[model samples]
Structure formats: structure tokens, C-alpha cells
Target: MLYNAVSTLGLSKRLQTANTELQLERLRNNDEIASGKHFDVAKALGARTGQAIALRNLYDETDQTLKSTALLQGRLGTMDSALTNILSAGQDVLAAASVGLGQPSPTGSSLQVRARAMLEQVVGMLNASSGNGYLFGGVEVKTAPMRAVQGDESGLPSPIQIVQDAIAAATGGTSSPQTPAETAAAVAALDDLFATPSASPLGFEGGFYQGAPSTAPRLSARLDRTTEIPYGIQGNDPAMRDLLQGLYMLASVDTSQLPLDAYKPYMEAAVAKVSGGIEGVRDATAQLGIHRAQLDDIAAMNTTQLRILNDQLDAMESVDPAEASLRMNQLEVQIEATAAATARIARMSLTNYL
Candidate 1:
């Protein structure tokens, strides 16, 4: 067991280096106070930390989406409220008109004023806008869904004019009659005029009232789809035309000549059509609400998923303090023992024996 001095020193140096390295590794792995600078365990933990950070990012994104959905839903709800108000106004007008027609000596001036007010309110509803854009404009974010025409004898707003303009524009340049025709021949001529590429190139070309094109011209609102939702009603839609014409006729009828009983049928029919329009608007509002609710549910589900993912990431990345403390203690003991052995071995010199 005789060992040369140089060989013993070399072995001692190697042992010291190995013990120091082991202690350093333990320090890195342990979640305790560090004795000196060390990074072996930290390097391994760093990889896990990176994964945790990525998971956090994902959670953030999901949370953001949830917030955005909530904001949009709120906007949609506001639009629905506006629609409800508009419907209420329309109902009021219909009720007043019906009563006016029922009066023994009908004076429809008051009813006509009320009807005008209701029409204005309907225009307001059609022009409702949200944060992202106009709600009724059907993806036309910049343009108002309904435009009002001022100072026109037609009593229609600019939005209606825009519709006519679009139709006229589409057909090169030919203006259709603004007044309703009295006789069947006149109506037939009007229909032919609408059909002959002279009045409406962009309207309905066939049916009972075929040849009359859509009043509201479809505009490109969606980039992916060419189909457009005409946001306004045309005067040609039998329901709308009849309603308007009936109102005008009522306004002109002399209370002294035509008995109120005679106009009752027209008033009733107009009321029904107005009611139908209100119902249609209500249905659309309900559909929007449902869509919003579904989005909310999806957002909630995403939030839950994000939470679970975060927990999993924490488990994968977080340190176990108890285990780290135990490893640290074990390494300390090994270092002390190695130091004692080295001191003893180094002291066993030939000079001591002599």
C-alpha cells in the first residue's frame, strides 16, 4: 500500500475536485440557501420553467378572447334593446291608425303624424351600430344601414333614395314612376317598365308583382361572399307599398264623404304587415342573443381549460422544497467526510514517521 507523494497528491486533488462538483450539483438541485454560485440543477429547472411560461401565454390568450366575446355580447344586447323600442313605436302607430279608421268621422291627420314618427324610429333602429361596426348593415362597417332623404316629396329618407339610386345606377339611367298606378293597365305597364332594364336591373324580375326590383339594393359587405343583405325595404314589396299607399289614401279621404267604416279593412291589413315586420325584427334580435350566449359558454369553457393547463404547468415546473432540502443535507455530509479523509491522508508524510 506504499504510495508516492506525487501520486497521493494527484489522487487527493481529484477527490477534492469531485467532492466540490458533487456539492455544487446538490446546491443547484436543492431549494435551500446556496453556499456558493452553482447552476447544474437550475439549468434543468430552466427547461421546465420555459414550458410553464408558454402555458401562461396560452392562458393569457384565452382570457383575452373571453373578454372580447363579453364586450361583443354586450353591444349586441344594446342593439336588441334599440330594436324593442322601435317595435314599440311601430305598434303604437298601428294602434292609432286602427282607432282613426274606426272613428265615426275619421280625421287621420293625427294618425298620419304618428305614423311618420314611427317610421323615423324604425329608421333609427335600422341604423344601429356597435363597437366593431354597424349591426344591421350586415358587415358594412363604415356605411349607415339606413339613409334618410330630406326635402323629398316622397317623404322617404335618403337611405331609400340610395336604394333607388343603386337600382337606377345599375340600369344605366331610367327613373321609374314614383306615384302609384290606379288601373290594372297602369300597374301592368309599371311592371313592364321595371322589367325592361329601364327601371330595375337589380330588382325582382318575376312573380305576382314580378318585374319590380328590390327597393334596397344589395351592397358588397362581405369579402368572402358576394351575396348581400338589402338592409332597407322597397316601396314595391306589396306589403310595404300597400301600407304606404293606404296611408296616403287615408290622409286624402274626406271625413264628410267616405265613412270611416270603409277604410277599416285597409287599416287592418296595414296593421298586420307592420306587426309582422316587428316580429321579424324581434326574431333577429333573439337569434343574436342566442349566438352571444353560445359564445359566452365557449369563453367560460376556455377559461376552465386555461386554469387546468396552468395547474399542470405549475406541477411540472415547480420545485419540491422537502426533497431539495434532503438532498442538500446529504451533500453537506458527504463533503465534510471527504474533507476529513483528505486531511488525514495528506498528513501521513515520511517526515512524521521519522
Candidate 2:
């Protein structure tokens, strides 16, 4: 009989290698079961791996956009609340003016007090902030939009002083208008200071607003792939100017100082301005509502897109839990069997057969 060499070392090394491979496969299957994704995505997807990567990137971008839209929605909601309060405050001032005209207090002192308080309240509203930034600051969100023009606490001039200056400028040193022409001129001066864009130190931009210039475009945000919306409301909005002008006019003067004829027209001018402001604010609120509705529609579309993208990613990268578990069990059995066979073969010797 021909003698054949039994290289047990070589056979044992091969069995050990096979056993290691089986153990590695078992670990991979276990990972797949736990994560519900492929252990080796590139190896599994091969040539389509680039597509998988692109899809994942797209999903992340969409998710970011949705989150941004949600944040903007929250900001819009905050703006709406501030605007609602402003409207209510304006109405309060309006009611006071209307009532005071019919039944005048001895000096219209009570109405002035009410107007001052209302002006402070409205300024507070304009200076309102969301957690992210100021609501009425336009793009200058880090700063308060309006200054406090209420008490002597602030070194800044009060609304009364501003109106007094406007009156003096218009009438050439009169404490109050003495005639209809003077009244019209005074009102016009007040409008110029409060509502017109001018270099006057008492104007809305100089005395009140400390935010982005009204000429600057309002803050805008990307709503979708192609749509951008400018939704920010500024403190220097025409509506805001009109309201502040009316409030300052009402707050600054004493009816007792004016002739009866001048007093009636002055109060009428102020009330008319307040009424215009109220209407303008309502329109602003309505415009914000429309933008909010558009955001809602965009949110819905994003949600649907997210679902579809998730499904596509799942088809490309996700593993069936049941199938992965079954494979893991098979791999476990195979690894155990390989370990046992390697152990037995490692101990093999030709002397035992002999």
C-alpha cells in the first residue's frame, strides 16, 4: 500500500478559517436583525449604492425644510397674537377718543392718560419677540423695534414732546393751533413726522423705530423648492405709523388749551387716522392668514414627500426582521457545527486510525 501523508495541521487551519467565517456571518445577521438595515449596504446594493446615497441626502434636506417651515409657522403664530393685541389696544384708544369727544372731561385729562397707556401698550406689542427673534424688527431681529415713549424713566423724548414739537414747527411757536388752517397745518406736520419718510428727529424712524429701515425688504423665507414668502411685519409699517401718530396726537395735547373749533377738528383728525390704522392692521392680519394657510399646504406636501422617501429608502436599505432573524439562527447553527468540527479535526491523528 502506498503511504499518504495526513497533514492534520493543514486540515485544522482550513477548518479554523471556515469556523471564523461562519461566526462573522452570524454577527452580520444579528446586526441586520437589530438594526433592520443591511450590514453592508454598499456590498448589497452594488452599482445602485450611489442612488441610495443620493436618496438619503434628499431625505435629509426635505426633513430640514419641514423643520424650518414648522419654525416659521410658530413665528407667524406669535406675530398674529401680537397683532391681535395691537388691534384690541387700538380699539380701546379709539373708544376713548370717541367717548371723550362727545362728553369731554374738564381738561380731557383722562383721555390723554388713556392714550399714553395705549401708546405704551402698542409699543410693547411691536417690540414683542419670539424665542428666535423680534417679530417686528424685520431682518434686524436681534434688536427691539420700538422705543418706550411712556414714562420719564427713559431719557428719550415722550410722545407728548414729539407732538408738541410738531405743533410748534407747524404754527411757528403756538402752543396749540388757533385756526382751521393752523389745525390742518399742525395735523399735516404731525403726519409728516410720524408717517412720512423724512429727516426729522421726531419721526417714526428716528424717535420710535430702532429696527431695519422701512425701505428694506421685509424678512423672507423659503417655503418650498421654488416658493419664497416675505411674511415679516415691521414696526414702521404704514399701519403702525398711522396708529402711533394717532395715539401720540391724542396723548400729547390738552383739549383745554385749544379753542373749541380747533379741538373738534384735531380730535376728528386723530380719530380718522386711528380708524385707518385699524383697517390697515386688519388687512395685514388677513395677509398673514393667507401666508399661514400656504405654509399649511406646504407642510402637508412635505409630510407626504417624507413618507414616500422613507418607503423608497426602506426598499433600498432596510432588511426584513423575520428573514434576518431566521438567517441568524441558521448562521448560529452553522457556526456551532463548524466550531465542533474544527475541535474534533484539531485533535485528529493517524495513530488513532491505526
Candidate 3:
């Protein structure tokens, strides 16, 4: 066959183009081997690139949501622990009060002291917090949910003083109730003071609560696009109010100063109030347990969804290292062969053949 200049030039150009193409293929395959992922995901996936992007975005969002859920779970757990501690403290006071009623102590001195210490302990627990914020603050998480028992220079009456004033008002400035009628009136006044919109100027809400009010929205967390859980418990809750009221009633007066007429009726009322508070706290704790279970379920479902999403993403975007390496080796050999052929064609001449 005759090898004309035009045909030789055409052949040489084609070989050069083939060599360059093989070189590019080798480079792409090498990259795939190193990275374990498609070098150009959009190019490899074509029209389906959007699906891959959406899937990856969804995976990222779910991961973020799972992290948030974990934090919420931690907060809920912290609140539950604090509330359990409060229950324990309440029970201790109940036991002390029951013992006082069962046996005679000089003016119930031991019971009074126990109630005061436990009252402080319970208030401290109600003010518990974590990295996120205060556990019992409701929607207000930055500050302590319960005020210190001692009022500040701001002139607010201390919690103990509030209880004392309520008693004085009910008993007509007497140290203890004068009769059964006075004892009943004292209990009613104490209840009113600790009620939602307290009757006294320095009642529970006015003097003790430092967090969100009852009318404000409760704290909550979102598990997903559609699921939200409200798990906040405030210090001013009715159960907490009753428990504190019972403790304060015992702690505020010296039982030694009281006549039997006042002391017997008073101790019985406190015991009953504390008992009711214990039951209410247990119910609240049970409700928190239910919420925790719900969070566990949501977390498990999120884990499963993440796993499936990861698998799908891997199938779409990952490459096998062994296969990529093998292809790269083949491309290298083809590129070398094409380069050798192009060089041979460049060296060819009519004079050499002659």
C-alpha cells in the first residue's frame, strides 16, 4: 500500500488523539482508586445527579436532627433525675412528719430541723441545670428556676417570711392557731398564698419563682419535620408548690411554743399535703418516662433511616478500588502503545525504505 503525505499526517493525528484520550482515562481511573468515589459525580450520574444530591442532603439533615434529639434526651433525663431527687426529699420530710405524729418529741424539734434542711435540698434540685440550660425553667432556661430562700437587697420578702406572714394573717398575729377554726383558716390562707395567682404580695410566685410564669409556653423539642415533644416542668407547678408549702409550714414555727390544740391539727394537715404532693410528683415522673421512651423509639428509627441512606449513597457514588486499579493499568498500556505507534510514524521516510 502507498503511504502518501496526507494519509501519514491523518494517521499520526489520530494516534496522538488516541494517546491523549487514553492518558485522560488513566488519570481518572487513578483518581477513582485513590478516593474510592466517582471523580466527577455529576458526569457519572448524568440526569440522576439530582437524586444523589437530594439523598445526600437528606442524610445530612437527618444526622443533624439525630444530634438534636440526643441533646433533648439528655435534658429530659436531667430533669427526671432532678425531679426524682425532689421526690426523695419530699418522702424524707413525710417520714419525719409521720414519725413526729407517731411519737412525741419536745415540740417536734427534730422534725422541724429535718423539714428545713430538706426544703433547701428540694429547692436546689429544682434549680438544676445542664450545658443547655436550667432543667425546671420551662421556656426560660438561662437562669435559676427557683429563687434562693433568702431574699436579696431588692426588698422582696424571703420565702420563709412569706409563709410566716401567711400564718400571722390567718391567726390574727398569734404565734399559733388559737382554735380549730383558726387552724383551718391558716391552712386556707397558706393554700391561697401558694396558688397559681397567689393572694399574698410575697407568695410563692412573687417571692420564690424566678423562671417562666404559668401562662407562658412550655419548653419543647422537635424530633423531625412533623413531631414535637413538650417535656418542660416548672418549679411553680402545683405539685412542687404543695410540697414546698408543707415543708415551709413545719419549718416556719417552733412546735414547742404551740399548744396541743394547734400542733396536732397542724402536723396532720402538713402530712396530708405532702402525701398528695408525692403522688403528683410520681405521676409527673411517669409522664417523663413515657416521653423518654418515645425519644428512644425516634432515635432507633433515625438510626435505621441513616443506615439505609448511607447504603444508597454508597451505591450511587462509590467505586471499587480493585476494578479502578485494573482499568488504570489497561489504560496505561494503551497510552504507551499509542505513543510508540505515533513515534514510529514520525520517523518513517521514503529514503529509509530505499
Candidate 4:
């Protein structure tokens, strides 16, 4: 059958489409060279799209968790320093109290001064903020967990007085006793407060802690695909509270008013509490160390996983540089041939056709 005259519209459209395809190929090559990956993430992976997507999502989540872990690490680092200082202060108080038992006026004044300084330090730590939130406030991240000054129904008296009264109440009543019995009572009171703060008059509600629910959701960070870590040591923690209580008691003592015998008992009680505080802080630091180790392991796993995922993705979509260059060169030659053919075809006359 005789063919109709070549349609000019179709020829022009075909030429335009060929030129567009060439441009798109060049653009895709450039993109591959620049990105070192497939031009289209999903299309390149084809049957492997599900796994590629899942791996990408997993990496993204792991990356986000690592970021969060970094931030939490900073906060925990601050806590570590604060707790160390507090532990040291407790040791110092014990030493000073020991010395105070020997010399009445001067040594006692020194202990009191040191205790006051430590009180400031401890309170500063308790109310410390990292980034946008308080360190010791647990879930109540924005609020200060400890107050240096005294308060009314909303809060208790100065840290020392509240501790003293709590101790007194634990023994029997809040009546003043100029004896060793009072010191023992104060120790019992501290135990009572930590044990059942809400039940006791000088509970966490009335005294020191000002944070989220009593059992706040722990601050957490991602460890891996199937693991997470929870943390956020609060001010009301027995170890921290005991440390503060020791500092308060040391600051409250008056060497002149009480005889060395009475003073000795007070210091003894304070020393025991302070020692407990030191142990508590040490334990917290140790636990933080464990978390840091875990993060390191998780980070390593994340890096390895990401590398493997990237390799798989590259395999799916990456154009070999040498092959891409050869293909590009081939396309360039084809275009040149097409241009020549079109030029020759355009010049064909009706006379030549007849």
C-alpha cells in the first residue's frame, strides 16, 4: 500500500520528544554524579522499595533518637558534676563536724559557714536548668525543684527547719529536746519522709520536691529499633534528699547555745545523713555511666546499619560513572545522526518522490 505524505506535525513532534528525552537523560546523569544515588529513590529500588523505605525510616528515627540522646547527655553531664560537688561537700561537712566536736566556738563557726555555702551550692544544683528545663524537677521540667527561702502552707520552712521538724515529728511530736534522743528522732524522721512523704507532715508535697506526678514518666531516648532507655533522677530521690537534709542540719546548728555533748550528737546524725547522701550520688553517677556506655553501643550499631542501608540503596540506583559517561556519549552521537537525517529529509522534493 502507498503511504500518505509524511505528516509534518508528527515529524516535528517526534523530533521535539527525542530532544526532550536527551535533555532528561543528561539531567539524570548530572543528578547521579552529584548525589551518588538513584535519580528516583523508590523507582530505582523497584521490588526492594518496601525494604528501602523501611530502612530509610529506621535510620531517620535512629538519627532523631541520637540527637535526643545527645541533648539528654548534656543534661546528665550537668547532673553528674552537681552530684560530684554535693558528694564532696558532704565529705567536707563530716570532717568539719569531727573537728567541731573538739573545738567549740571557732570550729563550729567554720562548720556552719561551710554548711551554709554548701546549702547554696546544693540548692543551685537542685534548681539548675539545662536548655529550657529544670534538672531536678523530673516531669515538671520548667519549675524550680528547691527553694532556699522559707514558705507557708504552699511550702515548708528553711530546708534545715523543715528537716528538723520532720525528724522531731518522726520521734513523737515537734517538742524541743536538748538531747541525743532528738538527733535519733531526726534520723527516723528523714527515713519517714523519704518512705512516705505524703503520709508524713513534711512530705515531698509540703517540703522539697516540686515536679510531675509522684511516679513521673522517665525521660527516655532511643537505643535501637527495639530498645529505649528511661531516666530523670528527681530531687525527692532518697539519696539527693538525704544529702540536702545533712547540709540543712549542719547549717542550723548553734555551737554556743548547745554544749559539745549535744553538738556531738547533732554532728554525728548529720554526718551519717551526709555519708548516705554521698553514696546515693555515687550510685546515680554509676548508673549514668552505664547509660552512656549503652548509648555508645547503640550509636555504633546505628552507624553500621546506616552504612549497610546506604550500600544497598546505592546498588539499587547508582549509575556506574564510566558506564554513564559511555551512555551519554552514545546518546550525543545518536542525536547528531538524527539531526543530520532530519536535515536531509526536510530537503526532499516532490519531484524526487515522483
Steric clash pairs (candidate 2): none
In Å, residue 202's CA in model 4 sits off its true spot by: 5.4
- Model 4: how far residue 321 lies from native, Å: 0.6
List runs of model 4 lying over 4 Å from the truth: 1-4, 41-45, 102-105, 149-195, 198-202, 217-222, 340-354
- What does candidate 4 score on TM? 0.81
Candidate 3 global lDDT: 0.85
* Local distance difference test scores for all models: 0.51, 0.85, 0.85, 0.70
Question: TM-score of every model?
Answer: 0.51, 0.90, 0.85, 0.81
Ranking by TM-score: 2, 3, 4, 1
Taking all chains together, the TM-score of candidate 1 against the true structure is 0.51
The candidate 4 region of ten consecutive residues with least summed lDDT is 170-179
Per-residue alpha-carbon lDDT of model 3 for 1-354, expressed as tens digits? 985545778899999988888888788887888888999999989999999999999999999989988998888888899888989999998987887674346747777788889999989999899886888878888978787766556587788887888889899998667677888899999988888887677767768887888999988888899888889788888888888889888888776556667767887888888888888889999999999999999999999999999999999999977778778878888888898899999998888668
Q: Output the better candidate (3/4) by lDDT.
A: 3
User: In model 3, which range of ten residues has the least summed lDDT?
Assistant: 99-108
TM-score for candidate 3, residues paired by index: 0.85
Candidate 2 lDDT tens digits, 1-354: 899876778877887888888888888888888888999999989999999999999999899999999999999999999899999999998987887574335748777888888888899999888886899989999988888775345577865677787898788788778777888999988877886476577677867787999888779998767989789788899988998888888887776567777788888999998989989998999999999999999999999999999999999999888888788888888888888888888777779888
**Local lDDT at 66 for model 3:** 91
Q: Write the per-residue lDDT of candidate 4 for residues 1-354, one digit (tens) a residue.
A: 997777755786687678778778878877777777767777766798988777778767767766766777787788777777776777777777766554356656667788888777777777888899988777888778876634435544755567667655654664333566665666666656655345676565546666754566766665555877666777777787777777777775555455555556666667777888889888987897787777777767767777777776667667788876777788788777767766766776678757
